[model samples]
Target chain A: MRKKGLSLVTALSILSALVWLAGLAWVLQDQFFADNINRQAETLKPDTAQQQKEDSSGKTLQIAAIGDSLTRGTGDPDGKGYIGYLKEDLAKKTKKRIELTNSAIKGQTSVQLLKQIQQPQIKRQIKNADVILLTIGGNDLFRGGQALEELESKTINKTEDVYLSNLKAIYKKIRMLNKNGIIYHVGLYNPFSDMQDSKTTSSIVRKWNYDSANAAAAQPNIIYVPTFDLFELNVNDYLYSDHFHPNKQGYQLIGERTASLIHFREEDQK
Target chain B: MNKLVHNELLKLFRKKRLFVIILIIAALVPLFTYAQYQEVKTTREKLGNVDWRTQLQQEIVDTQNRLSSSRMQDDWRKYLKIRLAQQQYYLDHNINPQAPGAPTFMRVFVENSIDLLLPLLVMVVAADLVSSEASGGTIKLLLTRPVKRWRILLSKYLALILSVSFIVTASAVLSYAISGVVFGYGGWGMPLLTGFSTSGEELVTNTVHLIPQWQYILMEFGLVWFVCLVVGTLTFMLSVLLRSTAAVMGIMLAALIAGAILSNMVSSWESAKYLFMVNLSLTDYISGMATPIEGMSLGFSLIVLLVWAIGGLVVSFAVFTKKDVY
Candidate 1:
């Protein structure tokens, strides 16, 4: 009886071991096969060796603009957003051509943009750029707009001064990194221009533009373009039916005005 | 009592039962590790030239498209939730879930649970644990000793419990040791995605917070032993319940196989939750990969399994302690 029991154990033990081995084999599929995607994002910082490929003069001008929903094709029917209009306008006016890279993620702030710009892939492009057009610090201002039911007409201003300082710091840092670059600090557009508190928020918005212009003025090759006039008090002419982003006409007008502004700058530089 | 427990242990090791457990560990450990190693190697080779974030974003978009294209309306939302979460997580953290996360030891220890093996190992030696002695008429000689019948049974039970615990610990430790050989020993500090959810709210799926993978293994083994203990106890019960050892083994085996099959097939029937076998593979349901019979939560499944186990123990003790040892 003992020998028979022992024999049964031996045979069963072998079978059990085989099955257990199979189960273990099934579970460890990831370690041997799965890709290390995380390391890929971090390993490649801006390759400094690629820094020698500079054009020295005006090659094809590469422009990068970033911002919130307006820049993210949020309110655009065709989904090209402002970058497309800006590109068409610039191409039509300059007729020389430009490379536009729109890296604008929806609902991003300046702090986020700064971090994004520091990424190796983006930093490489920014280094070779002739112009950097950016629309930012809007989401930071009107973040409470999402809670529109609870807080409307009430401006979030006190902490905004710090926001502006952060914005200044980002611009200053970018200027230091990329010398001889023209900075187009695209000012805010009043989507809520019809509101009674629109004028007060407009100054708050203008102060950012004014502060940005001053900050840009203090740094060489930085220019602030005031776009508030194109949208404020004439809400109907520019804004979409949603009263958030601008319509095609509104975008075209802004594009045309921006193209004109760049033309004047080119003439001034020449 | 201690001598008997030790005697039981010695007797256990003297046979193939202990060797089977060791064999399982030896075979499974390296296999699990190598599988993990292969995964990393394949990943390394595929990502040999590709950019990580773009690849990750593309994967997310691909998965999103796949989810959007197929799946019925009811299944669509769940698939979308998974896709949406991946996209949000990718945009926020720049990670691709379909890509590699951790080494083999951590993956095996945490994700794919070894719930089936323990009860199975128990079932191997368990059928003939006591009844085979009676069937071969060796009980007459064994009982001739000063050791009482209940004492003998108690010793066997204790011995069985000790062996079960040993098998559990061995399986888990071997999994870690073997996987470490292939994947490297980096799992100690690594974070794992232990994400589980009921409704829409995101649960912190970080595999680190709730418990270590080893503890999860231990808990799993504990539940396995408890379930197997019930199996062993019932087999031991049947050894007394019937005169034929073959009949006892066959009945228990059939019950287990039927339970496994019925758990899957006997769906929509709410009462199927009470079946002990339905909850045997408890980890799958606990991780929310599959649902327990209607209205069954992890806690609910645990209670059901425990009750069946304890109830089995009661029947085994009652029947075995009072059996005619003719």
Candidate 2:
């Protein structure tokens, strides 16, 4: 009986291991394999001229969001970051298909983004995008050092003017990438709102946001959304344990605020 | 000792373990070879109908068009774009992508053996050797013979080593013979372009090289032997730990499966670099990209395997010398 029990346990263990592998494969396959399969299926679907015209309406309303971890669903306990809600909100407000493709890596900077713009993959996304969004410039100011603890200790000292100029370079690069792409620059928010440095950071952030907003004004098709207003004082409600990234509620607000920009665009288009 | 060896060989003939191991090797080698056969068949089919180079060039253009609008976050997508572009460039410039000379079948086998199934057969044979004798109580009878204890164990070890080498070589031979039946043995001499990276712009030394197909097969046979020995030594360690034949096989199999899992998810853990599974897959480095884990240099992985082999050797010797069976 003990031997039989042992064999049963071994069988159970192997089965569980296989199930784990199958589940993981199902998820990754759903992502990579499903894209190809779905695309193939879509290709086979007949595209009537009337259907093409209907799809065209959705194209101008499409929002293409690009950013660092914040835009990539980093802080949200749920998988929905600002982009997710913005997608949903615009869909409901316009009652049309408001599509979004998030092109955000965990650790990317404005300088890297400028380089990314030159890459063929990023270039195509920029060219056809009706609405473009970005939350870059953090990694450029503070380089990632593998660990958060190390990042805190190895922080660099740069004045407000230097940060503003770098932010200016990023906006300029985006304009150069797409002369006609409608743009949104989500302003930087304070994670450490309780501390005195929050004010200092907020002021610097305001200056940075001012430059972003100012630059957007210079370009005709750009919109600057102040994300700092959503979560500056509500630390307990929004920030995650790391005290840096947003919690689910904070991201909801960010998404709604960003979606509000899309809603405004949709109304103007109508 | 020669008479004992003859008797042991007779005993092995009657029992199913050795036959089962050989049967398994024969069965599995064909599985992978057949998979390769199917893929090549499909490629040949596509090649027959269209200009193969033009199809590849069109794929490159399509990938470029898709990539032109992204933030470029996915590394795999970037790698594909780079690869397709380089292939396109080679075709565009009228430079041969497949190179001029041909590699021998032997060299190709050795290079590709680590990728598929030969290591699996090694597990089957090595996991059962000593522990099966112990579990059957045949070990007591073998010890009772006129031969010295150390000499008897040493002889069994030598037998396993010889059989392992033969089995590994047999697997490669079986694959070539069987795959030749289906693939029809063409392109055995075509030069294969390897060790090129389009990740960077400079096109740093495409490193075109060639060898006969037969030599490639032999080198692959030797590489398979190394890999089997590593796996055999690991199973041998498990056999010592469990002492029961079935238990040893189970534990080693579990370890094999787990090691594969841990290596893939081991993003931050430095200690996972020491694992044999990650160490054994060094062929990826030869492809000119960094390993799955950062800081896991090829040299570090080899040293870790050497350490494990040495540790296994020391344990087997110590236990075989001192253990009592009453």
Candidate 3:
């Protein structure tokens, strides 16, 4: 038995050594002298058929949330943001499973968002979403308090013009991606409602929301959900420690509001 | 030389060291398979059986959210950024990088073990190759043979190489046979992407190409075999220099564990890249992970390990031939 085992092991080891040596040679040849022409010719065409197969048998509701930090749940200790709260509320109301793909980046402006939604995976998410949630224009407007420092209507107007066009383009892209999905563009609330320059900031945010709502209105099945009133009265109580992002209670309020809108749509469909 | 190597192999087989290594691998593979099975189960449950694309999309979003935070360490942030780009590349190419299969498990297992677990096993077989003979007073009798001292050492080295190859092969076979029970054995033909390289924080996919999972595993095992051979050679050198097997193991264990720890924080050390332990993660280059140091590539690591192995061989032969046997 010992002699037989010794020979068998030696033979096996020698064979393995040779095979691995071949693999090593292949690695050098493949990595260093890769045929660039073959690689370039192997352009990856996104498999749309498999994606449709995933969509057609979907019993669950695919909710795709894309945009800025609010959609990303920044400042919330739980990191649920408004989307998390909204998901909880929807779960309570609906029997179907809620699968959320939140592709929001914190501090993302409208321009960045336009670029983000253009990514192949993000576009696939949008295409598969039964309902789309959008919360942009915060970073474009707040600029992380830089706008508060530069409270010039001239600069604000210039920013809004660029933002409005981006918003239009984003809406066109979403609509083009999924014709049936309802878009709920969550309007921004003024975190500085109780501050000294509340009037100017509030007006600026309202006008920005108004233009975005108008852009949403132009697209079919797009509903601009109002969140301005939720924080208008107790803005300080709802604001987080940063005095910028919404606290847990504020996210819950936004979540409850969006959940109500989605409920109404479910009822309409029924 | 053939008879000498055969004699060495006989001694090695009589020790049943290879059997123990195989046993160790078999015992550990199931534990990892269970852990991996639990992870996939939980992810599927959390995502409500959504397609992999959505799951990957969610992960990308989560990484983006983490990247947006201010408190993350710079190195960690860079690693995450590179990983995010690689994951995106996988998604864009419509390839499921983590598709569950026995082959996938083997690839992941070998990639993880190449640095530490595997080298330790190789050490077990190699650390006592010469030291035990010396410490047992068998060296005196062996040296009296008409065979040249260098040939004896060369036979020992060849035997070590064969056994190192055997250990790596055992791991690959055992991991696949065991993990296949749970993950199924179908992903051998599954398409995978490789040749992803990183520059700073950017994942350079200009050279990215598709290869089947079997080829990927073969290539990774090749890298694993090379890493183990270097580690085994170093241990063999120590075995020759020391009369105590325990001392050989202690030194190697310290160096390997230190290398594992240093690879985490040595991003700033800049010069630790020359150590063979840090360079043991040669598989990472193939999978396109962020290197421990800024400039360590597969080619760079391969060359570093080769130099060290050559140095170890030279020192082993020099000391073994010249040392006075009591």
Candidate 4:
């Protein structure tokens, strides 16, 4: 009986070890044999027939917005950032049903956003968009207002160069994925216009916007929408309590300008 | 050899401490399940009338807000980024961010079980495995049996390994059974996605694996079992070196706790990654939780743990075979 028990114990130990080993192997297999779906260089062309039909029938106009906190609806008490208000504005202007898939995450910089756009879900959203809205470079430029306060022109210039290249890469990648969608790259506004170093901060923001707008102009079908003028006169009225993000009124002003731009081509078609 | 292992197993089971360990595990599961239930209640209340996508967006904003604060650490910021990416993934896919259920509770339990408490319990058994015999004068009787000292020590070590395996499995099983009663025995077939992020880098959201809940649990158990084996082996070595069970247990407990504390405190210190204590959390890497140190990969941690386990085994075997019994 004792001999039988000893063998039973040994067999059980071996069995348990084998089971655990098998589990470890199975889980590790995914890491070792990962699929190359993300790396595949295939571009998904937007279906023209569907677009033409939607254009004719005034069907749902799919809009995908990808970027940082400004695109994520932060600081607005209603939590509907510019994208939410943009959807409402677009819905009011056109008979087409507006379907907006906002894939913007808060605190994301240009490099992070570039990586986010590569995700399969975001790719799918981008593939189906009639218009792709973006709001980046805020985190890249502002860096939580620390850079604005310090006022290092050389450091700001260096950071802007890296951001512009990242922006260029982002625009290229987006166009590669969806060749026909109109890409509206939203320009930055001066959140520190009310601050002590408002003049220097404004100039730096203006230069960054100018370079970014020029980058947008270089790409076909990518339009750069300026917002510096919107907050130039009433920065406090538009900014939230946090002073970083826009309040509801601020997002409304942005939404109105974006809506007018979006409506321009459709009104031309009409 | 088998009889020696059998006898060691019998002696281990005869200890009341083993039963107390089971009792403690049994009691903790309900408390954790209740806490999970409370969390779900509060989340549901907080998210009332709001869609999951909107909720996820708000959660991302909250995380970002916390991250912007100067008090937050770099490790926490990295972890929040991964969490934000995960919530974004779920939002994009329209999957509800984890509602409290048996599977969710079990997943949390498994993730948290590998911490100091579980290792401490495993060490309790290991710290006494060899030392208890020496303290009780049973080593002389065992030596009189004609079996080689190496064989005798090997049997005790095997018994400790077996006990560690049982303890880990038992914890998993008990957590599931108890949580199943409260939340229902469902979600075994639900999909669980894990995303691994490189140290200090943005979360690689695209590299997610959608394994079933059962497979995730199995893999978690496997990872925890390896950690337990390392803890048990190291404690067994300490048991052999120190004749007093209390001394072995105290030292092992202190080391395990210190490892957990150090992993949290000195996560930025690159050399902390090489410490065996810091590498005990293999589940974090596999579950796609942010690693303590930047750049510490699953493979790197496994190597670190393997080196420690082997070194401990070699030291234990060498000392046991050569040391005088008297």
Candidate 5:
């Protein structure tokens, strides 16, 4: 009986080890080789033609916003970045249902945003958008004030060159994915206009805004919305405590300006 | 042979060490649960009247802001990117992030509990298995039996493996039972999103895998079990070589702790990936955590761990059968 019991215990131990080995094999296969099971869940029947017919009665305007923290609505205590406020304003004025998908990630540089545009989800959203809003180039130029302390003319010029080329690539990629949608690239504002070196920083920001606006001008439906003048006089009042992101009132001003631009285009289309 | 194995099992159960492990786990469950409760209260207070969609968006922004600072390390940035992707996913789907409840807490406990605490506890049992017999001079009497020395050593190893399984299962049950009292037993069916890239390169938010909470828990169990098996077998080999239980336990415990510290500190070093302790965290791969080094993968880690386990087993059997008792 004792011998029998020992053999049984040995058999059980071996079996358990085999089970563990099998589990490892299974997990390995699942982790590396398993095709996405969620793909089927994402597939919706293509209904663009049917949706357009329904939209004539009462259309739902689709807005896809991308770029950095400003687009993400950081520093706004109300949690509605400028895009959120813009959605509300556009919905109220147009009296049409508005669907907003904010794909913006905070602190994203121009290169990161360019990479983000390649994601399938972002590409799909951009394709369906009637209007695309973006806020970039702040992180590229400012880099959270690290670039300011170590400012050199050569470095600034080199960085700006890389940024502009990246911006152009981003525009080309978006246009490739979406040809008809109007792209509104919100220009940078000088948050440090009230600082001791306000004059120098202001000049650099103006040059950045001018070059960026020119970049947008080269694209067919792209328009550059300027926020420099809005924050020029009351920089302190428009900025949050961090002195980097805009306060709630500042976002409201931006939202209103962007809405006005979209409003006129909607009227032209009608 | 059966009676010898039974006697070894009896000897392990009679010790106070096993009970101490149980008591410690029982005490930890409620402490973790209360801590989770406090966390949820503060988050809800901060998010008063705001919906989960906006809250998730804010969380993404917060992680991004933290990642922007030059002071942040690359390791932390990688982790933050994963967090950012998860929050982005919740926002995209309009899924209200699950609040800190019993099921969510239990799930987290299963996912993370193995990293340090469970391994330490299991090592205690494994480290004592053979060394104590030698220190107490009981090996002489045990060897005098009709069974061969190899059979005796194998039986002890088998008992240690059994005890490791028991301890792990008990931990799971205790955590589930205790946390269930407060959080309720309703989250088994909730869909859990896994497979967010921790690679700090381009954010690939599209490759996430969705599995139910129950299935995820089962996978975590399997992974944790594999880790414990490797740890237990290795420690048992150490216990066989050392005469004093204290020395065996101390060395294994130090190795376990050091592995954790190295995995955190020099994870960038390619050589660090070959350490068995560093490779113990197989759950990281399943949950899509960033690999400690650049090129380490789930397959690479598993192969490393399996090689160590097999080598330790071979050395243990070979050495114990040949070494003279005198």
Candidate 6:
């Protein structure tokens, strides 16, 4: 019996050795010699397209947030930003499960965001979103506080024109992807509102917000949510140590406002 | 020669090292599967019923956010940049790089284990192959046989090869069988992208191509097998040199653990790439992860490991044939 067992084990080991040898040879053939094969043309069909269609009836509230650092929760110590707090608020208000996808990159400007939404996965996320939360124009206007230092109207005008056009394109793309999803375009706040040149920066920010709000108004199901007033009263308290981004209290206030808008809409729908 | 190899196999089996190795794999696979399952569950809970695309998208965004931070190390930034681009490529192709299934689990399991866990397991079997026989004074009886010394050594090496193959296959089968219970037994035909090469921080996709997951896993297992064989060969060499099995195991253990540590910090120490332990992660190249050191490619790692294995084999034969035995 022991001899028989030994033979059986030997046979199995020999067989696996041959199998691994073949695998090694195949690696050499596939990784090195397959360059002549036309590989770039083989496009993969989106596997999730059918899966997405099948699961829409479950009624989970899909919240897709996009754009710059604010949406990404940059200044908030918890890294939840307004969107995280907004998620918490909405969770408290609604019985439905809130599914949130924050595809926000810090320091992303409007042009970069326009490019980001063009990605297939981002497009798919937008398509499935029941409510879209957007925060942009901060990096375009602020340039990480660089704009505040220079305050050059000509350069700012150039940036704003490019930004407004990109914003219009982004809005058009989101609307095209999802006709019914409510777009809450979170407006920018003047971080330098308490500074010595508060008048110049405040007017620049207000004009930026007004123009962005106009763009939001032009699109269907898009609401321009104002955050200018939230930080305007106590800018120092709301601003993070960087003097640029919002602190936790500031993000919480923004979250509450966005959540309230979403909350009442959920109530109205019910 | 075949009968001699058969004799060596009998000895190896009698020791039950193969059985013990398989048992270890079987015991650990479920642990990893549970950990992986919990990770998937937590991600699902966080994202709420989203598809793998959203999960992958979130990862890409998170990497991008990390890259944007100024406080990150330069090499880390480069790694993230390359990974972000690769994730983007996977997203663009509509292929879910992490589709859930037994095959996917097996791939992840092997990829992670190739560098250290698998090598250590191979070490456990190989460390004592010749040293134990020498320490036990069985070398005198074995060498007293009429067979040529090289032939006997070759048979023992063949048996070691067979056992290495057995251990790798056991890991593959056990991980699949155990993880399949939780992750399901599908995704073999899932399409995946490969051939993503990095030039500095940039991901060069000109040569990128699509291959099914099964072929990808096969190729990766091939790389894993090669890595294990090289590590096994080095351990076998150590076994032949030292009379004490403990000494052989200790040296191999220290070198392997050091390799694991060095791969993390060796981005600045470029020449460290030539070490066999650093090259043991041959599977990483097949999967297109950033090389621990720049200029280390699949070809480079394969060549380095081959040279080391050949060197080990040469030393084992030379010293085993000429060494004085009491």
Candidate 4's C-alpha runs over 4 A off are: A1-15, A33-270, B50-53, B64-76, B94-99, B195-200, B205-207
Give the alpha carbon lDDT tens digit for every residue of B1-326 in model 1: 97776666666667667677779768866666667668757755654423454345434434543443444554344545554563444444433233332343544453344334556667666667677777878878878889777788788776676665556556656666666655555544322232233333332233211223333343444444456656666666666667776888788778777776786666567788787777766555333344435455555766786687677667777777677778
Residues A157-204, candidate 4: write the lDDT tens digits. Answer: 888888999999999999988888899988999998988988899999
TM-score, B chain alone, candidates in order: 0.77, 0.77, 0.99, 0.94, 0.92, 0.98
Q: Which residue pairs clash within candidate 5?
A: A73-A81
What is the C-alpha lDDT profile of model 3 across B32-79, one tens digit per residue? 999999999999988775478889988888898788889999989999
Ranking by TM-score: 3, 6, 5, 4, 1, 2
| Runs off by more than 4 Å, candidate 5 | A1-26, A32-270, B49-51, B67-79, B90-101, B194-208
Docking class of 1: incorrect
- Residue A35 of model 4: what lDDT? 76
Q: Cα deviation in Å at residue A142, candidate 1?
A: 32
Q: What is the lDDT of residue A116 in candidate 5?
A: 79
TM-score against native, each model: 0.51, 0.48, 0.96, 0.66, 0.67, 0.94
Best by lDDT: 3
How do all the candidates rank in terms of DockQ, highest first? 3, 6, 4, 5, 1, 2
- Report the poorest 10 consecutive residues by lDDT, candidate 3 chain A: A261-270
What TM-score number comes out for model 2? 0.48
Q: Which ten residues in a row have the lowest lDDT in candidate 5 chain B?
A: B49-58
Candidate 4 yields a Cα-based lDDT of: 0.79
Task: For model 1, state the Cα shift of residue A27 in Å.
Answer: 22
Strongest candidate by TM-score? 3
Winner on TM-score between 1 and 6 is: 6
Model 6 chain A lDDT-worst window of ten: A49-58
Pitting candidate 3 against candidate 4, the one with the higher lDDT is 3
lDDT at residue A65 of model 1 (Cα atoms): 63
Give the distance in Å from residue A139's predicted Cα in candidate 5 to where it truly belongs: 8.4
